[model samples]
Target: MMFEPTIWIGAILMGLSLGLLGSGGSILTVPLLVYIAHEPEKAAIAESLLIVGIVALTGSITQFLKRLVDFRLVVVFGLPSMLAAYFGAYLSQYVGAQVQMLIFASVMVLASGFMLRPISALPNSNNTPNSINSRVDDFTVLQYLLLIIAGIAVGTLAGLIGVGGGFLIVPALLFIAKATMRKAIATSLFIIAMQSFAGFMKYTYLQSTQELSLNVPLIILVTVCAVFGVLLGGKVVNKLPQARLKQVFGGALIPLSAFILYNNV
Candidate 1:
């Protein structure tokens, strides 16, 4: 099938969003793959997993080199997420396209809500090790439970919708794990990488029964662009006004979500 130039534009923007925002860009992949690229919902979701996972893993590696990632948190949060994501991907075969789009649209709305929040309102994770240690001491059983639950939720969503779940995972890391913003971002990328891959593998296995196939060349093209975008984003992240960026991106989501819901409903 011939793809329009608009689809390529959307793919570039999707990667750019990942590079710039870290997490929000993957949300756009499903819509782009489905509507612009004209792929089936299930195939779009599955392809999104591969695209988001590759981009996220590249970002995570950059973060790791800078010592921003928390391996301990990755283990604590990622294990359950990986398992749940696989299950969710497997279960997705039973859901209809319209229903899946409805669910995905709802999630887009939720993610927009998170994105619209002023960054200033979030807790600063700039504490020194000694200070962070004290806060860590206050971590309780409830927080642990919340972390596990959050992990499962993120994993399942990643599997079901083909998102990286970084929007949800970042907050959970900040609140439940008491990770600093840098740590949370870095760690969230790691978890997303794991969850997305697990989901993608499940989807691949399930694809045996379906006649639909992924556009491997398109996937490669988008992945390459996204990786470049991540590098570019990393370089300019400090110069950009993050709050304004978030606000704009968040505002854009509202209309997109409504559009999806309108079409599906």
Candidate 2:
């Protein structure tokens, strides 16, 4: 749609990956913008943020409509993340581009590790505590504090990397909130959308002095592909063995992060 074969090809691939895998599309977008579109690293980061925000937000709507989103957890996580995202954006403006890229790559590597980590066996599928006297059955104030801390840390990373923070957010929901995988994914999307908006605003303020141009055709093409991708992903996610999928996804990321970090540095 933008009449740039490479960019469109990249967008299509990104969309397809997002639909097929839940979280790898943003990782693909950065290299595509840099190598294929020949965009500068900084511009590519900004553009990727916009693209990821739009794509995730669109995917989020489906989860929301299905009543899968947990707003309580979203608020608990999203609030701190929003504040940290602004801080991350401010830091990005002053930091060198290569430093930012290196940081982004490091985060991806860590996130991949998290994705590959084994999930513990839950006592129950509902994730609701069965007894008041049970050690794991209580929600203490400290747990909430830990959640907020995790939110801020991951949000800072998201703002730095232009990702939606799902890589961190999903596991966090599972570990801290004790949410089911399905609920964690749905809640993470809502938080990502919120955090992305905050991060986008933060970056927008930093780049306010520059005249920006939107590649309108690019947006349409990406959005269309993203819509289809989300639907397709939703259809297939239930069929896959999540543990295997996560490991395969992590395997893909390690090398990519290394290459991007090396090239950018």
Candidate 3:
């Protein structure tokens, strides 16, 4: 299949979103794959898991080097998410394409609401070890249960719709783990890497008949371009005001969400 310029352009934008916002890019991947690349819904969803997983893993590694990730929190939140993501991927076979797109669009709306919140509303992190521990210790049993539930929900969404679930996971971490915004964002990347990989694996396993083969060259091309875009976004994110960035991205999502909903509906 001949690759369209829009595919590469979308890949760059997706990466830039991840690098700058840290969570919203994967939401765009499926649509780009389906509309611009003309991939089937199931195949696009499965491929999105791979793309998002790799990007998140790359970002997580960078966060780890910066000592921003909370491994314990990742374990607590990620295991259930991984399992649920697997189940979601398996179950996707029973779901219709239109239904899946509708679900995906709904998630975009929900994610947009989160992004629209003021950055000042997010918890501040000192980026200290003691502070991280204190936040974890403060979580009640009820919060732990909530974290598990949130994980399951996020993982299911990732598996079903091909999202990384960072939009959901970051807030869940803040509320349940009592993490700082930076830690929540960094840790969310790690969780996304694991859950998305699990979902991708499950999707592959269920494709026994191999009804659609993955576009290896296209995936490689998009991934590479996205990596570059993320690098550019990372540089720009530090220079931009956080609140302004959130407001801009959040406002953009409104119409994007509406477009998805309208087309799917």
Candidate 4:
């Protein structure tokens, strides 16, 4: 692929957003892939899925090595998510690009709203690591069943757009699994990486003739930049008030969604 400065800029922004938000940032990737890289909608969506998967994996691996992952929940959510993602990819093959863009924009609007909500805190007693250790809380059958349902919904959204579904996953873990905010974020990243990989593969299999229309060199540069950005973002995350940060990040998506919808339509 030929080099393009525009795509490079887009990728840098994409990485920066991911670093800042931890989720919903991948929502930028598809639009950037289309408008900046000048790729067809189908190709852009497919490639964006792959890139987001890679980025999420990179961030997740960093978190996982710290033993932050909730693998049991990941498995419960991921299985149904993968299956739903397959159906979503199949549906995308038949849907019009304009319609898809509209749907994608709607999903972003919802995600933005979700992000803007007040951060829910776990009980003070439960917040302690020792308290958590004393309780041998395994997933109940009900938890597993609920996860499958949530996964189907989230995976459908991810497959419909190029999002990694971290936005949904984070909140779901908090509300459903009753995890602390830190645990929810860490687990969200892990599940997002898994779901993105599954969703990307599902879409890729349905899609023939993968297109690399974007500036590959620039993509590499942006990916490299993201490594540092995520490190910085991780530091920043600890310093900032999470509610304020989430609101700022969530509110930004409105204009972005509007712009993409307007231009694409």
Give the candidate number with the greatest lDDT.
3
**Candidate 4: 10-residue stretch with minimal lDDT:** 127-136
Which is the winner by lDDT between candidate 2 and candidate 4? Answer: 2
**Mind giving the per-residue lDDT tens digits that candidate 4 earns over 1-265?**
3357765656656655555556766777777767766667776666666777777767767667867666766777777886777677667877877887888888889889988877654232135564333221566778767878999998887776767777788777766776655666666776766667776787667755433244456446656655555555655766766678778878988998898779767
Model 1 clash count equals: 0
Give the count of colliding residue pairs in each prediction. Answer: 0, 0, 0, 0
What are the root-mean-square deviations of the candidates from the true structure over C-alphas? Answer: 2.1, 3.7, 2.1, 3.2
Cα lDDT over the full model 2: 0.70
Tens digits of lDDT, candidate 1, 77-105 = 89899999998998888888788899999
As for model 3, its CA RMSD to the true structure in angstroms is 2.1
Instruction: Please write out the lDDT profile of model 2 over residues 111-209, one tens digit for every residue.
Output: 688767764443222435442122323557887888899999978876776776777777777777777666677677667777767777777777755
Could you tell me the lDDT of residue 197 within candidate 2?
Answer: 72
Alpha-carbon lDDT of model 1:
0.82
Off by over 4 Å in 2: 1-22, 119-138, 210-216
Top candidate on TM-score is 1
TM values, all candidates: 0.93, 0.85, 0.92, 0.85
Q: What ordering of candidates by lDDT runs from best to worst?
A: 3, 1, 2, 4
Query: What's the distance in Å from true for residue 199, model 4?
Result: 2.2
